[model samples]
Target: MLFNSYSFLFAFLPLLLVSWRLAQGYGPTGLALVLLAFSTVFYGLWGLPFLIMLAVILGMNYAFALALAAPEPEQAQPAATTEAGSEGEAEAQAKTESACMCGSRKQGGCRFRLSRKSLLGVALVLNLLPLLWFKYSAFLAQNLAALLHVQWHFTSPGLPLGISFYTFIQIAWLVSVYRGQVTPQGFTRHALFSACFPYVISGPIVRYEQMGQQFDALSPITAENLAKGFTLFTIGMVKKVLLADSIALYADSVFNAAEKAFPLSGGEAWLGSLCYTFQLYFDFSGYTDMAVGLALMLGLKLPENFDSPYKSTGIVDFWRRWHITLSSWLRDFLYIPLGGNRQGRFMQYRNLFLTMLIGGAWHGAGWTFIVWGALHGSMLSINHFFRACIKGKTLERILALAPLRLCSILFTFFCINLCWVVFRALTIEGAGRMYKAMFAGPFTREAAGLSATTDGLAGFAAMVARWLPNNYIQGWIPFALLLVSFFVVWALPNSHEVLHGRRDGSHPRLGWRPTAAWATGLAVMAFLTLILVSRKATFLYFQF
Candidate 1:
């Protein structure tokens, strides 16, 4: 069941919370078992076969963790602390990256009996094998068939829910064992680490090094945490149910038109693109908020996945902010493993391109996803090159100017918008159609389907009229919500910032509390979101 579903919000979470609280007195193992059991139930609800797949993978990964190395108190540390490098990549950052990819077999990693390196390789493959089979086997086979100029077909059993997410989480765990960044915990804890109900489906991906201790020491479900967690969940529910889903109508229409080879006016293409741009943020951001919030209620903290990515001034800056966990995973496990910025600038650029190409492919098994990754990879390489050319103080001065900073932010956002069109497309040809409409379409007022209005509000109204009937008063909702989203993303403090309060002078009074007013506001949002749960609209990132 989805976290936003009626069964989850009204039944599962309440029962789990009560059981978790009661089990706390029974000790850590008992409490952990309660969570693991609930997590199994939650995932098993999806399908028994998939749950079996998860269980088998978790069992194998845990065995690998135990086999690699027992927990060494002296060696254990957060994986992020393990000499993950940076120099020209000052803008690149992540919450948890791997150190296992470092060190050669001969010169380093001498601490092995029964060929630990070989075992680690086996474990990594074991984790990846299912993912490759279920998610990409058909994509791979089809491509191979095309290359051989023969008719060949491969049938896929379809993707298991959260297979991609849990695969990465488990890979990070097994590697952490090799790196001695974490001691393998008990089987129950290891299973629960990746299968935690709140984040199991869509994640701000957690690492064992960080979450291991939290699993062992789950804090009690207190009123303070309850208030905060529920407050955040309510906020996220509204964002997904109300804003993201509402705006998706506009985006879906335009994208559907483009996919069918329908010629769109420039205004229609841009309007669709912009709507989806906002929709993606609100959807993912909303899910992140809900995941973090729910985990908090269980007294386990998941790292922040986003930090106002829309405001990023450079591609590098955007990576650091958006999908913080996955980027960090790619950085530590993939990027650095391939020799990050350690080599000269050219190798760094090559690594950046390869890293992003792989990153894009990680999203899906389509050529369109590969193109998305390639675009970001290219952008990242160029961003690094530009930064390298400018000296320290000169770069600082350039960044310090408000006008340049604003321009940088706008430019980065614009580039991201173009790339997102490809990211959202059904196929390469469809993306080209949208791109043509966006860039190469006629500029004349009549030709481009202009409203001839300079007023921003009027323009949005006119834009909506193209797809929506003028007499449909409700047609204005998406545009109205999109305008509200602008204020929310750029101006308002995020869920984290609201809970923690801003570091800057602004929003001095923005902290969340258990006061009556806060409860009332959250109650209203929850009620509204609950009523709209009939849509059963899955979070967008769930597909990835």
Candidate 2:
């Protein structure tokens, strides 16, 4: 199901493009049908049961909306002389509140507006049902078993592919429908919007209204968009195939064999941990880039997800830079709903903690993830407290001084790396052991795994170990390359600058030099792909 796989990239994408473009010649309806068929095939690849579940939910939502939009019986008024002003006021109030879509409008005032309360009830239940089933079924079952003292064993059927994404898309759609933002684009557009294969598994979470415009627009693909699209697509492929995947191997080797992965000195463990952190960023973000790039090629502009987050000085700054779409989604849908900053101080903190806790839970069904989220939420809370105490004074003064900035940056990286232990660990116990080992002792040669005593485990130690021999030197080379790659990504220009209309963007003007640079980037990417072809790796985010 990964977009990077040979089956998806070479087989599925090509087949879909040909069929879709061919069908588009017929009309919008034909195109919609083609997309729906392909999307179903893509989803059905996960399992037939998932497809059935999806269909049932889609049907339920569609039916519920129709029912909500059905006309309500008029309330009988008492036979009393009403003032002219009162009658006019009632008419204006009705107009203000009633915005609905049911059947076709007639010459007189149409009765289409639904009870908002009823619509809300159906939307929340229908939209959240799948999320609860897929994400928390095991957790819920465990709690229920404990409560009832039942002997029933609960085993989780693995999640439906892209359930997280499709769930979010459906919820957003239903909310928009309830809010009178989306006119019914009919069934086909709704289906396509919910299950667009390119972005369903991992997403920029393309909104309902956004896709509606694209579905209805008569504009043909322009050369300018095509060029930008192809450029983005090529760059994304390079990032995923070459850079991200390459770094991941070293990260895996080290983390997987934590206790025995050489004599992991404090320095070595820190280096390895940081490497994994960066590896995850690139791996997940690279997949997102490819998704956005692919969508763009199809004339859809999926939102950007990351900036140069590593460059951020604070946790708040890091969150803003990383996973831009998800953070924004959580803010808009969850945080704001919980009162946001408009509420008093205690409530604001409550909302912040709850938002992050839920956000963490959204990532996975584990206490470790909850801890990871709590760590971030705590950092944010402390930062907020400091801001209030500091008044308008800048932390910039401290950061402007070289020592303070370096110390804080290094501390921040270490803190984030420590959190990754929880984020990456196989279990809570594994994380606890890793933490204990870090402070347990000084550098030693006792710890051993593959390439354990290779002497090139730590970069500084590895540099010193370079004069040792063949296997040791060879292993160190890959590690060295990984180190260099981290620095490159860490120092890379801000992707957000290019994504937004910021003056200082990562991409230069699209002149001949820039075009040549892109070509070089493509070549580097192809070489990376060749390296990775021998070892297929799943993207890190697929678990989420």
Candidate 3:
């Protein structure tokens, strides 16, 4: 059920859209049910066993949510877009120490004798069990065994697709339920939030409250929504199919070679790593555009995930701009819960470090991810410390200077790219190999043609082998694309900007409209993307 797959493009999505439109006439419930049913089918197609796992996980969470639910305490409104801004109340008093969701809200007929805090603790443990068993058990056991000097080996199961995202999203929902900030909407709403197909596989990783309302008062399907949806979807498809996948040829070639301990010329290493940097951004953010566009077609809005992250001037800024959903989730769930910045500067740095370490581990069962996380956590702590040391007008003036700002952006990009090398590598050793090559590998033909030596496989890399006619041409394409990626990322308005964009955050860029010209352009782009659908490449984040 990949958004880029032929069956999904021609059959499933179109059929779902028609069905969804017809169902909308019946009311929101009809729309929700149709979506939920199709979403169920979508996940099932990935693997029925995982679908069962998802269903069980969803059932348990819904039950826990209901158990945790008490009458919604009076509040202004469930936090909206500003959820990102205020997620970390690390200032304190946020975590309900004694009162759990169900403990005090409905004292009558309380099923559990446990207090709210205890119930939440238990529920949280239960909620994380599947994720732990599915994703981390082997890694944790292997480490524990090594630490204890034992010959113990642990076998782990295949990670269910979207479990990381599902776990995080539900944790947010469950926590919100426990916080008594939101009432349990219903079973269908619960399913819809957790299982809606758009964000189901690869997500911007939305929260419960963020989407609850979108499914409730879903506006009737309209032509304007359709136009915007198609336009955005087409743009995103171009990014993924035309750019990201194409760029992956270089990324995969370089990294795969490094993993096998092959000698990488400095140019090969950087070409691959930088290509990957752009590839990942375009892949995930491109997926975000398609996800948001799809939801919009159904009159739902997904939170924005990226905003020109490569343009970030600092590590903290990079985190804020990149993977915005996961960053907020970490702030709310991990950092704040660890006392955030409440205790003191020392504790704040400690919390930030620990939050990133966990965030990194969430990506995969490899030391590469932990190191990646640790590097980021350390950088973040340093970033915060520097901010703490710098003060008012001096800092402002330094920031205002164009030259210094450019240096800052470049410095930040360099650090991020280095970290991404660790993140993308298959192992810590492989990462070291990449770093060695990036820093000081031979630049000669003896390196055996960067990508050619890697094992036989057909992918974008294979496509590249055919598309690139000569060795010289092969080397130049990535550099050229990198230049274009840099320009697109730093100069042009992003998809959001193109729609409701301000290029400099103050001036409007050209935007889409419900006109024939826009419609025709989108149609042509869609047709081109459809031609690439036969490749059936999965989005990179789908593995996470």
lDDT value, residue 176 of candidate 3: 91
TM-score per candidate, in order? Answer: 0.86, 0.80, 0.85
Candidate 1 vs 2: which has more TM-score? 1
lDDT string for model 3 (1-544, tens) is 7888888888998998889778877888888899999999989998989999888888888887776774422222344456553563221113331233334434222233455566678888988888888888888898899999999856678989999998888888888988888788777788888999999887879987788877778757888788788788888998999889988988898889889976556667777888999999899988999999988888888898888888888999999999999999999899998999999999999999999999999988789999999999999999998888885758867876999989999999999999999999988888999887665424322332445455544444543443332321265677788898888888888888887666466634457776788778888888888888788789899878
lDDT of 1 by residue, 1-544 (tens): 9877999988999899889888888877888889889989999999999999888888878877876884222322323433443431221211111223222233323223345777788888878888888878988998999999999867777789999898999888888888988887578677888898888888888888778888878767888788888888888998899889888988888888889987576667877888899999989989999988988887778898988899998999999999999999999999999999998999999999999999999899899999999999999999999888875857768785999999999999999999999999998999999888777724444543675664476655555444332221236676687789888888787887888776574553667876888888888888898889889899898788
Error of 2 at 477 (Å): 4.2
Give the residue spans of candidate 3 off by over 4 A.
Answer: 71-112, 144-154, 441-475, 503-507
Best by TM-score: 1
RMSD of each: 10.3, 6.8, 10.4
Task: Tell me how candidate 1 scores on lDDT.
Answer: 0.82
lDDT for 117 (candidate 2):
63
Clashing pairs in 3: 100-116, 497-501
lDDT of 2 by residue, 193-298 (tens): 7888778887877777677877665233455555565556655666667767776665665556563433334444555566678778777777877777666666
lDDT of 3: 0.81
